[model samples]
Target: MELSEQVAIVTGGSRGIGRAVALRLARNGARVLVNYRRQVAEADKVVALIREFGGDAFAVAADVQDEYAVEAMAQACLERWGRIDLLVNNAGMSWDTPLFRMTDQHWHTVIETNLTSVFFCCRAVLGAMRARAYGRIVNVGSLAGLFGNVGQSNYAAAKAGLIGLTRSLARECALDGITVNVVAPAYIETDFVEPLPPLLRTWSIETNPMRRFGTAEEVAAAIAFFGSPAASYITGQVLAIDGGWVMP
Candidate 1:
């Protein structure tokens, strides 16, 4: 078990890529805290699945956008597990309005949910991690951040901010044995992409060298790697799980 006896906090762990990452980490022997904002049933299901598989897990509710809530969430985890070993900032939302039509509310919601949430969660756990001199922070980013996308200016900007955040934090924490990295996924087959216009979806698949959308599990694998000891020497990096959609 690569993560035996470790503790992990995965935001948005109720479903999709976040769910997959939580399950993977649990399978690797980490006691996981599945954090969700509203999907209590979904989060419980994930925890149950882990428990069924002989892995330790529990669900916690927190609006990652709220700094106080995030801080409390981290504190609760530390109280329950005695230490924090990994943190996955995967809670995010997307607003697809074109730049010209984007509203202040839309822009702010996306930025606060996707980008600012990372800042809050990272800060919440840094103290305990620094004290222990051990931590793994894997932020879930997006290909939109790497290559601009139509009607996704807000999402792209938020994700792009995450990349910058990861790099700077990695530099600050590297000597402390804490690694920070980003897993930028493109077109994963999740509810997040199910509402895409058919034409655009087709174009996305066609343009991708693999000619298909990647799976949530695939993206989770990358995230799990970054959250594991295997990635100890890796930091301040972005691993794109885009099925060749992003060469860089």
Candidate 2:
């Protein structure tokens, strides 16, 4: 689905799945704002790559968990592009720990990064989205949210929160011509998965029906579909890109 004449914001877009989603949206004809918290160099590279392919994009730094920063990012997009047609909430982090050993900081960090930021970003953009009577919001969730993971209690809880948030928001905004959906991915090939212990990595591969990890680009493709006009009528849905890892 083409996104010609659309404008999009992709959070945590400097690397991994966020990076791929940014590029895909740009390629589909949307002007992109790639949001990053730290990785300035990586953010610059993503912007440069988009420009190289004759796509419009720029990097913006914002700590998404901060409501003020999230508000500013949304305002920046509207100021530059005149409209924000799509929002891909791809910013997230995880610190694995058993429930017993999980410290308050660890719990808050994952929850704020993975869940609270989505709340901030969505609220900041909804006013504009509603005014236009058209918008697409896609949240990047995790399979752990659907089926809990060992040593990832915090992560699982936060991601699980997205399902409720997305569905409720989707219904609230459906009459406004805005759609909200979440995508759950597992065992993805990214920096997040690279550090998995050897035993865990092997087990993951063997357990996956595809016998492989999902690629960032693969996940981005699904995100792009949700962001495009083709998916206008689809909302409040969770599409799992886990290579059949979780199924009916």
Candidate 3:
């Protein structure tokens, strides 16, 4: 899908899925603002790579959990590009623990990072999107939230909440030509999954219908689609990039 002349903001864009999304959006003809919490070098690398391919991009550091930082990020995009046509809320983390052993900090940290940050980032961009009467908001979610993975209670709750938020936002912004959606990926081969025990990784692959870990590029494709004009009529939807794992 051609996103010619559009402007996009991809949070947590320094590495992993976020990094892939940033590159993909730039390739689709969108000028991108890659937002990172840390890993400045990695963020710059992504920007450089985009430029290498004749795509435009820049990196911005922001802790999306902070409303002020989130606001600044939005302002940076507006000042640089004059408008925001897409937002990919791809910044999130997981602190796994069974319900009985979960700590308050665990709950709060995961919720604020995964769910509340989306709220902050989305709020920061709504005004600009409304002004243009065109926008695409894509949330990177997980199958754990839909099927409830063991020891991921906090993460599941946060992502489930994201789904609810996306639906409401879709309705609220539909008339403004804005769309909101979520892409849920499972067993993706990213740095996040690289440290898992070998046995756990093996089991995940064996159990998946596709019999392999999904790639970040694969998930990035779906996010890019959701962020493009091709998906103009698709909103309030949760797309699973799990190689058939999310199907009944």
Candidate 4:
């Protein structure tokens, strides 16, 4: 729990679950790099919030899907903090459409944004972590990936692929003293889902055993757990924070 000198990079840290995770890590004494794509102001707000809570954090701009950008993001963290102790691959996007109507552009965007970005970020820090013999990686996955959902084929596929990536990287990096894991959350009440149709919103809540939408902070707590030293022995595992929505 004592991550006083750790440095963490959290992609998509501008809002929602990402913002929550960034704050949680900062609260635990990690100097956090809050990564965002286009929302500089929002990302800055996250940094402000962390500072308000007596934490060290700053916002950085980068498109996670861009390999060079991701590498640069990681480098920035290293240059500023001297080492990267944790990474949260939480940048992602989703488009709803039936399989037949899912265009090539849509499919490619989702896969690249959600899955390939994770790989690029992981690769960017792998060598450094191996050299230091220390690191923690917590990927943000989705419940749709565990149980197929209507109109989200692309998102589900990307998240499912993330699970595979988490497992593979965990095994490959364990010997180097790094841990990799995934945290799947179901329908957290955030800006993303706040505008959804009432029917859909109601259904999402009713489907959960708790009969309520999860909070961003609730999801962040689980993610932070996986990145802590206490969870050093847990790797290649999927921890669901979905309120019994998906048992797996």
What lDDT is reached at residue 190 by model 2? 95
Candidate 4, 1-248: lDDT as tens digits: 47898999999999999999999999999999999999999999999998998888989999999999999988888888889989999999888788989999889999999999999999998877887999999999998888877888999999999999999999999988899999988888888786677998888788889999889999889988898988989999988888887687
Cα lDDT listed for each candidate: 0.94, 0.95, 0.94, 0.91
Model 4 CA deviation exceeding 4 Å by range: none
lDDT of 2 by residue, 33-140 (tens): 999999999999999999999999989999999999999999999899889999999999999988999999999999999999999999999999999999999999
Which pairs of residues collide in candidate 2?
Answer: none
The better-scoring model by lDDT among 3 and 4 is: 3
On TM-score, the stronger of 1 and 3 is 1
**lDDT of candidate 2 vs native?**
0.95
Instruction: Estimate the lDDT of model 1.
Output: 0.94
Candidate 3 regions exceeding 4 Å error are none
Report clash pairs, candidate 3.
none
Backbone clashes for every candidate come to: 0, 0, 0, 0
Q: List the residue pairs that clash in candidate 1.
A: none
TM-score of each: 0.99, 0.98, 0.98, 0.97
Instruction: Determine which window of 10 residues in candidate 2 has minimal summed lDDT.
Output: 239-248
Write candidate 3's Cα lDDT for 138-186 as tens digits.
Answer: 9999998788888999999999999999999999999999999999999
